[model samples]
Target: MKRVAILGGGPAGAFAAEQLASAGWQAVLFDEKLAWEKPCGGGLTYKAYSHYPFLLENSTPKRFVTETVLAAPRAGAVSLQLDQPLLIYSRFDLNRLLLDRAERAGAQIEQARVLEITRQGSRWRVLTNHGSADADFCIVATGARNPLREVGTQLTACDTMSALGYYVPGEQSMIDIQFLPRLEGYIWIFPRCSHLSVGICGKGEPAGALRKRLEQYMTEREIPWKHGSFYSHLLPSLHTASWRRNRVTGEGWLAVGDAAGLVDPITGEGLYYAIRSADLAVRALLSEVTGLAEKMNLYQRLLRRDFAGDLEFGSRLARRVFHGRFLWASVPARMVQFTRSSPRFSAIMRDLFAGRQSYLDLRQRLLKNLNGSLYEMWMSLGFRRLVPRKAA
Candidate 1:
């Protein structure tokens, strides 16, 4: 069996390990912080459940959210019912579950941090705290701070974000989002199995500022957030200029998840993208083709075909929705009204939330809803005019 070495025990690495190991490959997964609690919302979309059904199996501690409340600056809030429920899990629970699946599928778990990965001929050498190992292929799923410069990948600060939040006790039946004033990120209350994962994320914002904003939001919402465990972490966000040239695959290796910067810039939602990319990578790695170059090319093609546009489009939409001029902004409120009024509009949002919608057609979806809304307004006006004449 061909051997593969994967660095990182997050969704991407673990999922890849599971797929490769189940297919009879010797897959070894490495991570120093295996099953550590990450400061993430841990929401899984519809596609995640459908594509990987096993995620919801075996009594995973998760909460189902059916409603999402969107709050725009000074425009109040609007609630949209999700056609499909979202699954929210604690990061630790979710990571542990995937790692366990990988191990069960025959992937060896190594609790060591990979220090370097260098290609030697057809195989790659991985140096970890435990020891050095050689594999036919290497997967750099070690997140945005990956040290594999040989893989030709870099995550700049401009394209990254800093997120901070608290884990507090709460009853979570729905998800809540409050748009930041012209910022690239928002404050969110995501209900996990036992508590609430509330946080504020902003690109280029200092930690102190984000903390102050979180405190203010906590106060306004009356969440009783005092004495909760606080967390801060760095996450990758898509940048138009650099994301297009992200070198994800090379001679004897491939990068998945945050290592390749496969993150949604707008929402900072990466769980879906992470697993999906890993799935594609594993599929490509398992192909019977003989050439490593061909396999890497296929991997890049898969990413471009499947999700490049979505990430770019998400970045654009994020800027439009979260721009600080929202107190008098029509776009944000118009979107909320569209969601409130149009079933098609609501369905698209639901699809997006469900991970069934693509960014390729997001514009078309919005335009179609806008046209329908206008026609309804015109018809309503005509009927009112006719009613006045009949009364007269």
Candidate 2:
């Protein structure tokens, strides 16, 4: 049997191992820290659960949130009732769940840090701290902070964003998204099973500045983040140009998840992409193409045909969505107001939150509904103006 060396036992690596092993391939996964917590909100959208029902059917501890509050400067706040609830899981729990599934599928799991990966003719030689392993192929699922420089997407300062936050001790039913005045990112408060993941992520900003902004927001809202555990990490938010040249696959190996920079630039969503990319990679490797170079090319084509193109478009729109002005207000502010006053726009926002909406067609949808949305907003304002005032 052909052996495959899978690096990084996160969602992508674990899922790939599970699929490959189930298909009768010899799969071995390596990771020093197999399961751990991350700073970002670990929420899976409807698109994820619908594609992979096991994610929701599992016995892992998770939270289902059906409500979200979106707030923006000068636009106040608007409450959105999600038609499809979000599945929130602690990163550690989620990682453990995937790893368990992989192990049960006959994958050999190793708890050792990968020191280096060298190509040996047509095979691979993986050197770990504990020992070395030889495999016919390699799968790089290492995250954004990948230590192996020879593999995965080469990320520059502009291709990443700083994500930092605290796991606050609290409980809530709804999710909170706060958009700042001039920042290229936003703040999120996602309610997990036991605690809240309150964090901020921004591009072209230092982690220290993002942390200060998050702390200020927490203080203003009386969230008591001082007593919470702090965490920070980098998220892949590749530029449009970077996507065209993204290094996903090469000879005898392929990269998956954050290592390949398969993340939603606008929303910072990676779980779905990670799982989806892993599935695609396995499919490509298992295809009857026979040629190694052909399999690598097939994987690239599958990714672009599936979701990479959409994410590339999103990267182009990220700046405008966060900082662009619309009708004398910021784009985020207008988005909040539109969602509050227009049912048409609210439906769009709901779909976007559920991951059912694609960025490639967002502009078309917005332009098509602009006139009707504006009329609805005007009518809402008129009705509010006609309401009787209380005693002043």
Candidate 3:
């Protein structure tokens, strides 16, 4: 059987190992912490479950969230419906489930830290705290704050967001997102089965400011948070430019998930991209269209094809919205009002958050609906502008 070595057994590595193992290939997964309590909210979008049905097979601690409340700066909160519910889980539970699935699929689990990797003749020599192993292929699935060496050397640096949050014991249902004025990120509350994952996140902002804002938000919302542990972490913010400059594969090795700069720069969502990248990487290797080197090259092509368009659009949209730019007929405040007043507008947002719509499709739909909304307003009530157009 062809052997593969996977470093950092997070969702990316674990999912890839499961796939390879199911296909009768030898897969070895190494991770120091197989079940980790990742600090941020652990919520997967709709298309995630749609793509991988097996994610819901286990009775792990999780919750299905349907409603969401969005609060723009200096605006009233707008409650919207998630037609396709979002699923939230504790990272420890989620990672444990991923590890269990991988092991059950015949992949060997190594609970050791990877120290270094060297390229030998037609093979990779991976050094671990326990020992070393040689494999035909290697995958680096280590996340944003990993200590692994330059496994994917060609990979460049991207902006990493400082994420700080708390898991408070509470009974809440709706997911809340509050946009900070002029900040490139937002604060959120993702409700789990028993507790709420609450936090603030931003790109290109002060760490102290993020905490101060989080505390202010908790106080204004009257959220008593003396119950759960507070934690802080880093999240990768790779949007269009970063995507264009980075390559996930080289020679006999490939990078997946955060290591590959696959996370959404805007939403800070990487679950879908992580699993998707690993799946495509395995397919590219298994194809062996030419040789291992050529197959790996194909992996890069596949990632670009699958990820580029949406990422570019997301990056542009984030700049416009978060930086307070106007979108033809709307700024952030006007856009929130549009969502509050128009069911059609709300549906588009629902799809965007639920991962059901691509950025390209969302842009097209919003533009088309803008004209219709204008016409509707003119015919009914002499054209009231929900979103005011800024003077150029």
Candidate 4:
């Protein structure tokens, strides 16, 4: 039987294993912890649920979420009450679901840290703490690099975007995204059944900075939720410039998910992109006619075509909105009013939230609005001039 080795037990690796197993390939998965809880906001957008049905249909902890309350740090907070429901589950629960599915699909689950990986002739050898294993193909699914750095790969680390996540005792079912005035990151409150998952990310420079920001946000909001009980992780942004070198695949091995730097820069959402990329990897592996290197290149091309514009656009917009306290406090109201009134404006916000649309989508909408509503644009321009400009 043809064998495929997948590293990491995160969404990407598990998804890849499930995909490959469905394709009749024997998949072996490795990770340090099988039920380890990784730090994430634990909120999935509506589009994410639509894309991954298994999240709701066959997952542990069950799916719970339907509304999102978006708030900006500014005085005139623009609120977007989403009509569609979102998916919110524990990362531990979700990971277990995906991993279980992969295992059921015939992927062997192994809990071991990968020490190193090397190419051996036509096959790939993976060195793990448990021992070494060889496979016809290897997939690097490691969420983030640890001590083991793959050869011919540039392991570039960015300033870690720290996040604090934990479940609080509460009675709520909606998700909240609060833009904090003093911090670069916003506070998130996602409730599931009986407990509230609240935390904050960004703005915290050092490791412990997130805790301080969370304390201030909770205290200022008069929220009675206690702190000192939460999980934190470094949310790494994708190194956009290194996509080519990252090469989703090599001679006999490939990479997926955060291993391939597939995280969406703006939203810190990786499940969608991770699964999407894994699908591409499975396609390459399954196509008997395609060479592995060619398949790798194809995955890169698909990523560029599938998500390039949206990622870049989101990053640029995030910088504008998240760079300073001023815009965080004021811009949301302006955007909410415009979005609610104009279908064209709504499309722009949709593009921003869901990566399906391009940056040009917003640009086109703005230009169209400018052509038809010169007075509205002029008023916006006037308001911009009225505000004290500060560096974002």
Counted clashes in each candidate structure: 3, 0, 0, 2
Error of 3 at 120 (Å): 2.0
Summarize candidate 4's per-residue lDDT along 40-97 as a digit string, tens digits.
6566665666777766576266445544556654333344445455667777887888
**CA lDDT of each candidate?**
0.83, 0.95, 0.81, 0.67
Model 1's number of clashes is: 3
Q: How do the residues 1-392 of candidate 3 rate in per-residue lDDT, one tens digit apiece? A: 27999998989999999989988899999998788987768989888888997776568989988999998865578898888889998999988998899999999999999998888988889899999998988888987775765665243344577889888878788999888887888999988877888998888887788988988888787776667688997787765666666756776789988888777778889888889989998898788497777887788888878875577667777777777655443266666776776767777888888887787787778788988765553543433355556879
Off by over 4 Å in 2: 388-392
What is the per-residue lDDT of model 1 for residues 120-202, given as tens digits with 9 covering 90 to 100?
Answer: 87778889988999898888898767766676358788888988899998886889988766567888899887789999899
Best model number under TM-score: 2
TM-score of 1: 0.91
**For model 3, what is the alpha-carbon lDDT of residue 295?**
83
lDDT head-to-head 2 vs 3, winner: 2
Can you tell me which runs of candidate 3 are displaced by over 4 Å?
153-158, 327-330, 375-392
lDDT of 2 by residue, 3-117 (tens): 9999999899999999999999999999999988855699999999999999999899999999999999999999999999999999999999999999999999999999999
Q: Which should have the higher TM-score, number 2 or number 4? A: 2
Q: What is the TM-score (0 to 1) of candidate 3?
A: 0.92
